[model samples]
Target: MESSKSASDEGTETASKVEVKQDEFSYLEREFTSELFKLEINNLGIFGIGDFKKMLKSLEIDAAKVKTPHKRDCAFICLKSKEALDEAIKKLTGYVWKGKTLSVKIARPNADPYIKRKNEEQQEDSNKKVKRTVESQTVPLAHLTYDQQLEEKDKEMRKVLTAFGNNLRKLNPSFKLRKDEIPCEFEKIKPSPKIDDYRNKSEFAIGRNSNNEIVVGFRVGSYSDGSVEVGEIAKLPHIPSKVKEAVLKFQDFVRQSKFLPFNPEFNSGHFRQLMVRYSEFSKEIMLVPGMYSNNLTEDDVTELKQSLKDFYSDGEGNLVDVDSLYYQHLGKRETGEMFNPVDHLCGKTHITDVIHGLSFRVSPLAFFQVNTAGAEVLYQSIIDLSEPKENTTVLDICCGTGTIGLCFAKYCKNVVGVEIIPDAIEDAKFNAEQNKINNCKFHVGNSDDYIQSMVKEVVYGTLKKEDLDLVAILDPPRSGLHKKSISAVRSALDLKKIIYVACNPKAAERNWLDLCKPESKTYKGDPFRPKKAIAVDMFPHTSHTELVMLLER
Candidate 1:
C-alpha cells in the first residue's frame, strides 16, 4: 500500500509540471500588433521581384525587417516543423511554394552549461578596480534671462535666413520662403500669404508663460515664392501680459535663431521653451474639440430618444421626426468607422504643376499630395515623361478625384477616367463640371471591374476608342495592379504607352513583372515592357518612396 501511494504522487507531480509549461507563454511570441503585421506584410508584397517566381516571392522584406529578433514571439512557438514556418510565411506573403527541398539553420543562444561563470569573473574584475584619488565638482554654464535668450535667438535666426534665401534664390530666381516656411517642435509653418489661398491667414507662433509657465500661441503662413503672412494671433486672457510678451519675444527669437549657424546635435527645444511649456503647446494643438465637447442640440436629443424608442418599443415600427432625421443624417455624414471625413480636409496628397492648372477637391478616401509645391514637381515630371498631347486619348485608371485625367484633358483631345470609389468619382465629376472641363468624363466602378468589362468592350470594338493612340496612367492602391486590372490594360490593343505611378515599390514591382511576363497577351501589338523609371520623394520622413515606371509596347 505504501509503494502504490508513492507511485500515485509521482504521476500527479509530472502532470502538474506539464500543465504549467503549456500555459505559461504563448506559442507565437511577436511583440507587434497583428494590424502592424498585416501592414508590413502587405507593404512587402506591393513590390514584386521580376527575377523570382511565386515560391521565391515569400523572401521579400519590408521596413518591418528592422524589428528586433527578441520582439518575435513566433520564434518561441516551437513550431511543429520547419514546414509550418514556411507555410505561415507563404500565407502572409500571398505566395505559393512548391519547392521540393527545404533547408533551415538553427542558432543556439547558449550552447555550453556555463551558468554563473561570468558572474565569478566579473567579481574578480571589480576587486582589481579602485576609487580615484580626486573627484571633480559639477558646474553649469552661465544662467540666461528670458530677454538675453530672446536677443541671442534673433541674431541666430537672421543669419540662417540670409543663407537659406541666398541658396534658394541661386537655384531659382523666382524662389522665396517665409518665416513659416521653416517649422520646429514648438510651432508649425504653413503656406505664406503670398499664395492667394493663404493670404488672409495669420502667422503661427508658440512660447511659454512667465508667471505659471504655460504655452502661448500664434499662427503664420508662408509661400514658396518667399512671402510670409501673419494671421490673427490669439492668447488666453488668463495669463499675465509680461508672460505673453516674453512668449512672443521667444517665438521671434526662435524664428530668428533658426537662421543662425548651429550644430544639429546641439539643437533641442529646451534651449528656447521650457519642457512643460512645450508639452502644453503640443496638447493645445493636437487635442480636438471632438474629444471633449458635448455640444448636443435639441435635434440630437430628439433623434436619440426616437432611436431608443424604435430599438426597444416595437418588434418592427418606424418613428418619423424631421428634426431627428436631420440630426441622424448629419451624424452619419460627420462620422463613420470605414470613412473618415476629417481626412478630406487634411490628408496626404501630392499636388504638382500637373494638378495646379486644374481645379479639383480630393475625396476623403482618395490619395493626393499634402505638399502642393512638391506635387507640382511630381506632376510636371509625369507630364514631361508622358507627353500627353492633342492626338492622345489618355485613360486615367484609378483616377480618384480625376486630378490626373482632368489635368491631361486640356492638352489631350479627350480623357476617360475610371475609379473604384463612388464618392471619389462624384468628386471628380463635380471637379470636371465645376472647372468647365467638358472633354473629360469619369465612371464610378472598381478599376479592376471597369477594365475587365468596359475596357474589354472597347478593345473588342463594341465600344469606340474615338482616337488613334492610347496613353494610360494607372495610380493604383498600395497593392498595385489586380489580376483583372492587368488583363484589362493588356487587352487595350490601342494602348501605346502606360505610366504606372506606384506609392509602394514592392507591390508595383510585382505588377510590373506580371505585365511584362510572357503569359500576358497582346491584344493589338507586342508585349509591354518598362522604358524607364523615376523615383519621387512624396513622403519625405519615413521609409516610403513613390515610383513612376514608364512602360511601352
Candidate 2:
C-alpha cells in the first residue's frame, strides 16, 4: 500500500510540471498573438482543469478593450523557436498541428513585417524625392532685422517698467510720481505697502480700493531705503450693529447656497471681515438683469439660452461646458484650436480655412495649443513639411487623441499613434472610429517603453530583420523625452526619419545633444542627422516658442 502511494505521488509531480510548462507557453503565446491564440484555443482546445487555469491567468483579454500605448495589455514573448511554441500550444489546446507563421494582431494592428520590410527597400527612393526639395528650400528670417529686433526689445522693457510704476504708485501714494511719467525700474519698486504709522510692527495689512472692493495686502521691506511699512483699508467699515448682524446672517445663507462659482475674494480674510462673501458679491454684480446684452451671434445666443437652462435647473447640475463652445467656434471659423476656459466667452471665431478638412476634439486634461489660430498654422506647417503619401507609414509619438496621425492617415498607408494618457487614447480611438479610419491605431503607455519593447518585438520577434524603415514623429512634453526614450530611439536600426517637435527649445536642445552625440548608442552606426529646423510662433505675445527639427538617415 505504501509503494502504491509513492507511485501516485510521482504521477502527481509529473502532472504539475506539465501544467507549469503549459501555463508559461500559454502566457507567451497570448502576449505575442492574442487574437490568433484565442482563435486556436476556442476552436481546438479540449476541456481540462489545467486549461481552465490558463484561461483564468489571461485576464488581459478584457484589458485590451482600451489599448493605450503605455498600458498595452500584451506581454513580451520570445518567438525565436515558433515551431516549439506552436507545437506546445497545439498539444495543450488539442488543436490541429499546422506550422502556420504567427502574427501580431491587436497589440499593433496592421503592423506587418512584409510592409515594414518593403518600406525599408523603398526609403532610398523616397529620400531622393525629398532631398532636393528640402535642401533647396530656405526659410525666410528677414522679418527679424537688427533695428526692428532692438526696437521690439526696448518696447517690451518699457511696457514691463510702466506696469511696475503703476503698481508702485498704488502701493505708495507719496512716492513722488514722475513728471514725464517715465516707467519705474525694478530697483525703484517698493517691496511692501507704505504706511503713515511708523510704530506698527505687523508684517501685512489689507486695504480697500477706489471701488470699495477689499484689497488687503502689505509689504514688509522697502526697495529704496529697506524700510518697513503697512497699508490697510476697510470696505463699509462703519456699518450699524443691526446691519452687521444682518450681514453675518446673509453670509451664512450664501455658504449654504450652491449657486456660486468658487471665488478667492470670499474666502480671503480681508474680504470675509466685511461679511460680504465673494460669490454673493459676484452674483449681485454679474447676474444682473440683461447682463449679456451684447450683439451675440445665433450660436452665442443659443449657448446663453442653455446657460440659463443650466443655471435655473434644480437637479443634475453640471459645470458649464466651457471648452465645447471654444472648439465649436474655432471649428466653424476654420481657425486654430483654443484651450483657455475664459476664451470660451468673449472669443470671436475668425473666418479662415486654416484647419479646413480637419477636425479634432481634445480631452479636458490633454495638453493642446491654447491659441486656436496659431495651432492651425502649426499643423498646416507639419502637414506641408511631412509630405505624407499613400505608401508612408507614420508614427506619431505623444499623439494626443491621434490628431496629427489621423490627419496624415487619409494620405498614408497606416498611422500608428502612441499616447500616455488613457483618456487621450480613448479620444484617439473614438476619432478613428468616427472617421471610419481603419489605417490608424492608437495605444497608451510611455513612448520609450513601447519603442524599446514593442517596436523591437514586432521587428525581431516577428520580422527577424532590422533593415525596415520607420519615421518617428516625436511631440514630447516641455520636459522632453526621458533618457531611456532617447536611448531607445537612438538604438533603433530601422528609423529613417525623426521629426522632433518641442514646446521648450532649451529642453529640446538637451535631447538634441543626446541624439547628435557621437558616443551615444542612438547615433552609433547610422548616418542620420538633423537635416532641417523650423520655429513656429505658437504664442504671439509671449516668450514661449515652438521648434520643429527634421532628422534623416
Candidate 3:
C-alpha cells in the first residue's frame, strides 16, 4: 500500500478546469520584463505543471523555470533571453500529444502587459483633455472626500459580497445560501474612525523616481501592471503624514548614501525596501529597512547598517522621529514570504499596541490589521456577532498576536489559540501574560495539521464541558485555511458556532460552503447554518473592507 500525496506535493493541484484569471494587462504601467514568454497550448487542459515541465524537457529545451498563472491550458517558460524564448516556441509549436495536434502560440504573460494600457490611458486622457499624474495612478480615489470614499468603498463591497454569496450558492446548490432557510444580510459598513493617515503599515519599494534618482516610496502601479517606477506617496490620503515624512527622509538618505537602490530587473544593489510600522496606541514607530548583499561584502553590509543607525539617530533621518530600527536580509523568491531573519538594530524590538484594553506586541512576522481604529471596531463587531458568554470556550484559529482570542477571552470562559508561526504564538502568549489573561493557550503549527487534534481535545478532551460551548473564531489570512481545517471544524458536532473574520470574504466563501454543506462520508459532522453578517470599513479611500459572520448549528 502506498500513501496519498499531500496538497503541497503537487503545488496547486485542483480538479477545476481552466482557472480563469482577470487580464493583468488591464492595469496601466506594470513591471517591464520580457525575458520570459508564455505558450498557450490549446489542448493542454489535461496536463498539470509537472506534465508541462516534463513535456518541455522532452522537447530538449533548456528553460530555467516553468510556471502557470493557475491556467491548465497555458505554461509560462522562464528562459534566459529572446533567443531562448524563440527556441522554446520553435521547439514546442505544433507538437503532437495525446491524439491531439497541439497548436502552441505566444500567450499573454503577467510580466509585461502595460504598453497597451499606458497607450490607451494616454489616448483617453488626450481625448478628455486631462493629464493624469503618478498620484492618480497610485491612489485614484485620493481626490474624493473621506465620506465620498467611504460611500464608494461600500458600493464596491456590496458588489464583492454579492459575488461571494454567488460562489457559495454555486458550490453547494443543495443548501440554499442567503435564501429563507439560510439567514444572511450585509449590515451597514462601519467607517474608519481616523479616515486619513489610517494605515499603520507601509512597505515602500526602493527604486528610482521619474528623475531616475534613487528614491524610497511606493510603485506608481502594481508589478503585475508592468510598473517598476517608484513614486512619492506623500499625498496618498491613507498614509499618515509621519509615515510620508519617514519615506522622504529615507529617500534623501538613499540619494546621498554610497549604496544604490536594489533593481528588480538586474537584482543588484543593497537597499531594497523600507517597511514602516506605526502604532497609534504606543505612539512608537518601527522601521525595518530591507537590503540584499548579493553585491556587497560583510564589511560593506556592516558599514551600511552603521551609516543607517547614525543617520536616523543624529542626522536628517531623525526628522521622522524613529523609535525602532531593524534590518531584513533579502531572499531570491519573488513572491510569498520573501524575507530572511530580521535583525533588531536599535530601540523597541516590537511595535506595542493595545486593542480592547489589552496590549499586544506586533513582531515583524506577526499579522496586524493596517487600520488600528477600525480594528477595534472590527473586533467589537466580531464580539457582538458571536456574543460570547461566560460558559463559552473560543477556539481562535490563525490567531496572530492573540488579539482576537484575547479579545474574546475576557468574555468567554477561556480561549485556546492555534497559530503556525512560532513568533505569532509567542506574541500571543506574551500578550496573554501582559494583559494578565491566563485563559489563552496558543500552539504553533499549521492550523489544519494540528487543528483536528486540538478540536478533539476541546470537544472530547479536557476543554469539553456540558454547560460550556465551543466556538471557532477563524481569522485566517487571505489564503484561507486548508480544507482539512474546515472539515475538522465541521467534523465535530460539539463545535456549534463559527465567527469568521475575513479580510477577503470572497476567498472565505469556499470555507463557508464546506461548513454549511450537507454532511457526507467525506464531511463527517452536522453542518452549520449561516446567520448574521457584518462589514467593517477598516480601509478608507480604498476598496478593501473586513467582514465578520456568525455560523451556528
Candidate 4:
C-alpha cells in the first residue's frame, strides 16, 4: 500500500509539469488537424453561426462549425478533407448571401483570447509560431550593409510617397507636382551617426526564463501571444555595455530578493518591468523599476524600496553609476494609462540630456529621443530642409521636452512650443531657462486648442502676418493626430509650411492626405503641396524609418 501511494504522488507531479507547458489553445482541446478550417459569413449581424451552417448544408457541404455565441461573424469549422476545403473556398468566396457578398477562405488559427485582468492590449495573432520565430530576430536585415539597408528603405519609401502624391493628384486636378519632387532624392535618406549601441533607453520585462527563474530581459514573445518567457538581450547590438551590465546586476538582485517576478497569466507577484534611460552626453543613467503592488504590507513595500536603494547605491548594483532611481507602482497596465504615478525613490529627480549643445532635463515620464546621436543628425536635416530664417517663428506642436524646437530656437525668430504633459512642459521651461534661451515660450495645453489663437496673437502683436514666416512642426504620436486637430492646424492661414515628422508613416498617411486634400468644409484651409520627403533611420535593425515630409502652399 505504501509503494502504491508513492507511485501515485510521482504520477501527479509528472502531470502537473505537462499542464505547465500547455498553451491557452490547449485548454480548449482544439483539433489542429489540416481539415480544420475557419468559416466566415457575410452579414453576421443579421444571420449568425446558426444560419452559417444552414447555408453550408444548402451547398451540399456536410461540414459544420463549432457552436459559438449568437452574434459571431466567424468560426472554426472542420471539413472532410483537402478536397472539401478547395470546394468550399471555390463556392463560398464572392457568393451572394443575404444581399451581401460572402467571403471565405482557409483561416489561420486565432490569437490568444483577450484576458480581462489588466486589459492592457488585445491578443496578437500568434497563429503561426514558425513565422513569429523568424520575425523575432534582432536584425533580420543585418546581413545587408548599412548602405544596402538604406537603399532598401529608400525603394520602399519612394513607392509610398509617390503613391501618396498620386492620391493627391486624383483628389484635386489642380495639384501639380513632378514625380522627382514627390520625395527629395535617394541621397536624402540620412544614415545614423552611430548604429550599434545607439539606444539610450530600454524597458526590460521582469518574467521567468525557461528554467522558471526570475530574469530581467526582453520577452521571447508578447503577453497577448500567450508566451511570457523572458530571455537575455546580450545578443542585441543596439544596447550599450553599461546598460547591459546594469541589467545583469539588477537581475542578480531580483533573484536574491524574497519577492517573485509578476506573473501576467496568474496576476500575482511583485516586480513587473525595469526601464533604464542612459544619456550619451552626460553619461547619467536613470532607473525606474515598475512593479505590481499586491499581497504586500506597507512595511513590505518600504523594505523593498530600501533594499533596491541599498543594492544600487552601496551594494552589488553600485558597479554602475546610478544617477536617479524611481519607483513606478503600476498595479495593472489598464487602458488609457497615460501618466504613470512615479515616486522619486532616491537620488536626483531628473537627468540632464544635452542635444545640439543645449541641456534638456528629462523627467521619468518625459518623451526624449531614444537615439541621441541619430536625433542630432535628423534634427540637422530638418533645419537644413525647412530653411528657417531669423524672422521665422516655428510653431512646434506636440513638443515633448522642446527638443526639436530648442535645437533650432537660436536660428528662428522665436519658438512657440506646446505639449499636453504638464511634467514635460515644466522640463521644457526649465531647460530653456537653464540654457539661458529667453526668446522661446512654452505653453501647457493641447496644440490644436491653442494653435489658431496663438498664431494670431504672436503674429499680430510682433510683425505683420504676411511679412512674418510661420512654419508648423507636427510631431504627433504613433496613432497620429485626431481629425479635429488636423482641421485646427489647417485653419491657421499664417502657418504656410508644415514639416510633419512621422514616426509611423503608415498611420500618419491620413493626416498627410487631410493636409494636402482639396480645400473642403471638412478640411477647412488652403491645401498644402508635398514639396519633398525624406527617410531618417532613427531605429537601426528594425523595419521602421522616420519620414520628414515638407509641405508648403
In terms of TM-score, the best-performing candidate is 3
Q: For candidate 2, lDDT tens digit of each residue in 62-175?
A: 211122223332232222244544543444443232332322321223233332332443544655542211111111122454344334534543453344345444433454
Candidate 3 per-residue C-alpha lDDT over 300-341 given as tens digits, one digit per residue, 9 for 90 to 100: 779888998999988988777889999888855454553366
Off by over 4 Å in 2: 1-356, 457-468, 521-528
TM-score of 1: 0.41
The true-versus-predicted C-alpha distance at residue 110 of model 2, in Å, is 53
lDDT of 4 by residue, 5-122 (tens): 3433443343245332224333224333433555544434466555767877898876734545455655556665767777877887787877877766566545334332113222
lDDT tens string, model 1, 505-534?
655656665565553233323556656555
Query: What lDDT is reached at residue 379 by model 2?
Result: 67
Least lDDT summed over 10 consecutive residues: which range in candidate 1? 284-293
Please say which candidate is ahead in lDDT: 1 or 3: 3
TM-score of each: 0.41, 0.41, 0.78, 0.76
Error of 3 at 204 (Å): 1.4
- Per-residue lDDT of 438 in model 3: 89
